[model samples]
Target: METKRLNKAISETGYCSRREADRLIEAGKVKVNGTVVGLGVQVSPDDKIELEGKLISKEVENIYIAFNKPVGIICTTDTSIKNNIIDYIGHPERIFPIGRLDKPSDGLIFLTNDGDIVNKVLRSGNNHEKEYIVSVDRKITKTFIREMSSGVPVLGTVTKKCEVERIADHTFKIILTQGLNRQIRRMCSYMGYEVTRLQRVRIMNINLDDLKVGEYRYFTPSETEEINRLVANSGKTMDASFD
Candidate 1:
């Protein structure tokens, strides 16, 4: 195998993203052939790679799973935090969430070992769709829906225009292409409404279906194929504008 950057090699192994791998390397947590390596070091597949003294095998079985996240479960891989999603599911393989869901909100979230796909899906420039069902504190209004669908100012910038539909007196369904921090909640709050409950039902072509809270299942072969097709043209770099 041709020599490749250390971060790229680590990311290809599905252990973490290239950016995260760089952080690990810079912190002296990564060693190559029994010697600590620095950022941008290149290595062949034959060279032994270790992280924190643990051998990192180049061969890893890639996994993609859809999880029905329950409310109060933090969308993080850090095991130190109480009730984090990684600990909740307890999947034996080392996997991490593609994106985040608010702790008080619940529904579908993707967990995977494929770091490359995570970057593609999270990049706002890609315009991937994420669908959600939201319940507000009061009855929905035409003006509320109009303002939400048009755009709302939050985090120092106006949110992108999205699709919003009233589902009930106090419930609505929204589809967004952007993943701003606390986006849905912030948007609702800007419209003089408070989100009483929020649940993500879909991401891209994958839906929550009947998956129970805290349960997870691997994607079907066909589902995986279509997902790849959808993101085939997506940029691998994260958009700082959305951050």
Candidate 2:
């Protein structure tokens, strides 16, 4: 029988990526053959791997879900946090949000058990498109459109040029390729405006569509394929600093 690192074995069970498996091991939630094991521990193929006292099966299926996160729900995996996204999702299988939407802001967020794709999708340099409709405390202006689409200085650097268009007197749609913390809000604030409401409507090729707030659905086979293709060249190790 072949021997593998504990993390590799756990990841091979389709429970998570090797990095997440290492996290679980470090958290003291992973055990081998009824005994707690530390990182770098090697095990035979026949050895049993358990996480949180539950046996991890090698045949576990990967899960992908797109959720319309409503306002006030946090984009955190920590169930202990009040109104965390994971608990609200109530998925039978373990899943984590790919990225975050601020607690006060709401829209589409992807949750998945496939840890391999998370970083790729979230990598700021990947230039994947994320669309949003933002409402400001004041009416929209022509100068605002020109300056916002040009670039806005915030978060110690200028935001990348994005597509901005008026959707209403106080609402507009913007598509961004990079995400800095409170980026849109900061940009608007820098221009003497304040974001009153923000909602993400699209990420990459996916859209929130008619999915009501707080509802979720599995990605269609075509959507999954296209997503994979889009991120195929993105490195999984890079920082997903974008929202």
Candidate 3:
């Protein structure tokens, strides 16, 4: 059997990215057949690979999880600090967030170990829609909605024109394809309004639904398969039909 790079094998398992695996290997955290191997070692399917003495499968099995991230919990892998989602979930399989949710925000957050999908979903060019329910300090006005939908300058660039609708006096819904850091908050603040609450309700077709805060659920096999196929070709590829 042809041998593959240990980093590649580790990444294929949907635990971490190839770059992250390399970091772990360099830090002396990974093992092969009970022996510690350095960077650039290749192992085949027959090999017994381990990470810190834990057996690691070297096949690509896509894992998708939906998490209702609560306020004050940072979406990071750093365990030194308490209230991290990584240690909170405590899944046997290592997984990382597909995207980030600001500490103050709460809502549906997707977690996966599939590096390819992570890259595909996060590529800004793919334009994946993220829907949010935002409540401002005061009543939402038609003028504000139009300005938000018309495109507002933020962080030295203009936010893409978005779908904005006023749901109530103080509540609104916005769907955006570009996810800037603290985007909704920054945009609202730019318009002389304070975002009292911001919650992501949907990512693409996945919705928070009834998943309560701090709760998590794994995606069914069919859902995972469908997502994999959808993201397999994300981003600016050189294939376009002759117009």
Candidate 4:
């Protein structure tokens, strides 16, 4: 059997992302065959792997869920932090969030044990659309809409041009193909507006319609099939451009 990096092996098990696995290895929390291993160590599928002293096996059943995340709930698997999404859902299996929604924002977010899907969905170069409904502190204006639809500079890079439409005097909807840190919020702030409320309504073909806050449901087989087809050609590696 071919050997793989310790972090990669751990990530494929659906316990966490490769970056989180590296952190655990650096902290001496990962043991291989009863011996703690350092970063970049290689191990095979037959090797014994323990994370935080508990054995981790490759997940046999691939679980995919769409969660209606509530405001103030963080999108992280770290059990140490209070009110993390993982503890909130309390799933029997270990699953990490596919991407993230800021703590202050809420709406549709996906959780899955399939790490390969996580990498594919997060590659900004794939041009997957994420739709959001936002209400700002000030009245919506044509100039604001035009600027938002055109592009906004945030996080040292200009955001990609995307679909933006007014929903109300103070509310609007946007569809983004790229995920930047707090992209919507930063864009509004740059336009002299403060987002009073923000909620994701759709991600690709998945929609949050009628899904209440703090609720979750499994993705139907059809949904999974369609998602797989959408990301079939997306890169499995994390793209640096997304950072």
How high is each candidate's TM-score?
0.93, 0.83, 0.79, 0.89
Deviation from native of the Cα of residue 205 in model 4, angstroms: 1.7
User: Which candidate leads the pack in TM-score?
Assistant: 1
Reference-based lDDT, residue 76, model 4? 78
lDDT (tens digit, per residue) of candidate 1 on 29-56: 9999999989989999799999988998
Model 3: worst 10 consecutive residues (lDDT sum): 234-243
- The sequence of per-residue lDDT tens digits that candidate 4 reaches over residues 85-188 is 99999998888898889899999999998765777888888888899999999999999999999998998989889999999999999999888878888999
TM-score of 1: 0.93
Candidate 3 C-alpha lDDT tens digits along 178-240: 877777888899899999888998887788999999999988777677776767778622111
lDDT comparing candidate 2 with the true structure: 0.86
Please state the error at residue 177 of candidate 2 in Å. Answer: 0.9
Off by over 4 Å in 4: 35-42, 239-243
| Model 4 lDDT, full chain set | 0.88
Model 1 lDDT on a 0 to 1 scale? 0.89
List the RMSD of every prediction in angstroms: 2.0, 3.2, 5.6, 2.4
Clashing pairs in 2: none
Q: What is the TM-score (0 to 1) of candidate 3? A: 0.79
Q: At residue 91, give the lDDT of candidate 3.
A: 79
Model 1 residue runs over 4 Å out of place are 240-243
* Per-residue alpha-carbon lDDT of candidate 2 for residues 1-243, written as tens digits (9 for 90 to 100): 789788766655656666678788999998889999889999997888889989876665677788999999999878889999988988888788877899999999998877777778877888889999999988999999999999988877888899999999999999998878888989999999989899999999999999999999999999999998999998655454456
